[model samples]
Target: MTELTVKKREAVGKKVKAIRRQEMVPGVLYGQKQKNEPVAVDKSAFEKAFLAAGETGVINLKIEGADKTVPVMIYALDRDPLTDKITHVDFYRVDLSQAVVAEVPLVFIGQSEAVKNEGGILVTSLKSLEMKSLPGNMPKRIEVDIAGLKTFDDVIYISDLTVPKGVEILNEPETAVASVKPPRTEKEIEAAKEGPAEEPAVEEAAVPADEEKNGGQQPAAEGTERPSEEKKADA
Candidate 1:
């Protein structure tokens, strides 16, 4: 668990933008059966704690002037899309004794012989799993071993995952965590490279009625007389 200090914040709405300039990141803390309180923490301190805690593990939030430190988990984080700076955060207070559900990231470890030796593509079907555990028992991340993947047909499933004694995985044991797919054939590779076919070009058969087809001259009217044989006879 990481311990971080924060201060109670009275700033609300538009004032938060100003608070950020002072290197104080504004956030709110709320949870089941917990009071919603606005708080602010030094951006540098918060970043250090967040990196350690991620979102699954518990954090010890010691607010200034508060009597007791609170256990919290990162509920949400908003970031600047372009800058990728942490904009605002939502902290979820958690009861140490009560069980809560969170998604723990799956870290794939070890090289698979199927991929290293054979021409196979490694596929990670599940990147995370839902788990229920007390705040004290929660893990920041889960590790899935891929060393057993010796063949393209082999896979690592949820049943193979190991967790802390108190943690409960809420997914089926048969769920595939990682596997090696057989290498793509030349035909398949070519088809993928070709992409979708181009649309057919428009034909010219639907020309407008006012437009001439054979030439610029319009056809002679049906009843119009033909020109007399003006051709001079051979002399």
Candidate 2:
């Protein structure tokens, strides 16, 4: 990819707010073969370049009076969180001959069969990776294949990636980038929703005699008809 060139700017002061009013952003470019120069880039043009190059995209920044082209990377970006507009930007001067370390995004290609044919979930543990590469050798993104992942035990490691020439991966070999795991089954979901089941106590069902005594059943009717047997014994 080629770098986008911006125009030279001479305006500097608090009144530089006027530059924004004119649809331009004020920034400084420094590093590599160039001195720190006050410059302004077209707001629209910069938006286009930023979209095309993204965060890792490189651009050829040219100033009207500069002696030569200085390849740069978007080092810092300032934007309005509410308006989603660019407020300012910082460009780092880089030497094409030297290697720079930056994080590149990971793009997953192909659906895992484990995720498609079986009930499984694809989990990503890493979103991007750090690499050291010269400005001219930078890659847009790193691609990962997930087609071979067909079971819950399958995992893709960082060491398995095939990096391009001039680029070096900066993470540990054992780091997991993505994995396929069994999804929560219907039974598991019901178990989670039901929480824990309580066991019934067997000892609580026996009723105490004292409580029954207080309930008024009437004692034996008190010897109502035993007089005949006593009279016969007396005769």
Candidate 3:
């Protein structure tokens, strides 16, 4: 459903800077065993279409002077670090008959009874699932229903996803998607605020001076390039 118009780019290196200043986004078309083609596309049009398609959905690329349109997906987007403006794009051409691997985002819908009445919290594990499907059959996003979580022990797993017929999920069926956790008790809250009790400090007994053992003069100073025994031997 998304589409963009792009023209074959002759600019490269520092010359591409001029292209961006002209309000065109320079890009490359690659993938599906085809040679990469340098091109420039309309800035505003490409932004809107890329936003809708993301990296998973397909887009119709209408190149300048080329009679045929190609099915492509936005593979990479280069943006200015400070301004966050679109600088460059990379489009991967898709073979319509072949299957493609893509990450499909999970959209959580509905309310859980545990969260509403029992004061339990919902925790999410996996936010997306990797899938393999034909380009035309690929879903933009998958919806995960959380209405079935009735108690703190209830959880939704990958097997519970409502996937379309042609798509194949690549994760384990037993992988948890979301779960309900029991609410914190008052005792635990108080313990958390008080933290662990500090241990009392122990005072160490002072060692007796070596002069007390030597019976007269103070012992040689510590680490003066000569040990006390060696100093006594030298004396």
| Residue range 98-129, candidate 1, lDDT tens digits | 99999899998988999899978899998789
Q: Write the per-residue lDDT of candidate 2 for residues 1-235, one digit (tens) a residue.
A: 6656677677778876888899998788877666787778899888888887767768888877677777789888888799887877788888788899888899999999999989688999999999899977778789999987878888899988898887888889899999998889899899999999889766764555754784543334456643456797997
Whole-model lDDT, candidate 2? Answer: 0.82
By lDDT, rank the candidates, best first: 3, 1, 2
Task: Please provide TM-scores, in order, for all candidate models, with all chains considered together.
Answer: 0.81, 0.74, 0.78
Model 2 clash count equals: 3
> RMSD for each model, in Å, please?
7.7, 9.0, 7.6
Model 1: CA > 4 A from native: 196-235
Worst 10 residues of 3 by lDDT: 218-227
Highest TM-score against the true fold, candidate: 1
**Number of backbone collisions per candidate, in order?**
0, 3, 0
Off by over 4 Å in 3: 79-85, 190-199, 205-235
Global fold similarity of model 2 (TM-score)? 0.74
**Residue pairs in collision within model 3:** none
What TM-score should be assigned to candidate 1? 0.81
Can you write out model 3's per-residue Cα lDDT over 77-169, one digit (the tens) per residue?
899999999899999999989999988889899999999999998899988899999988888899988999999889899998888999999
lDDT of 3: 0.89
Better of 2 and 3 by TM-score: 3
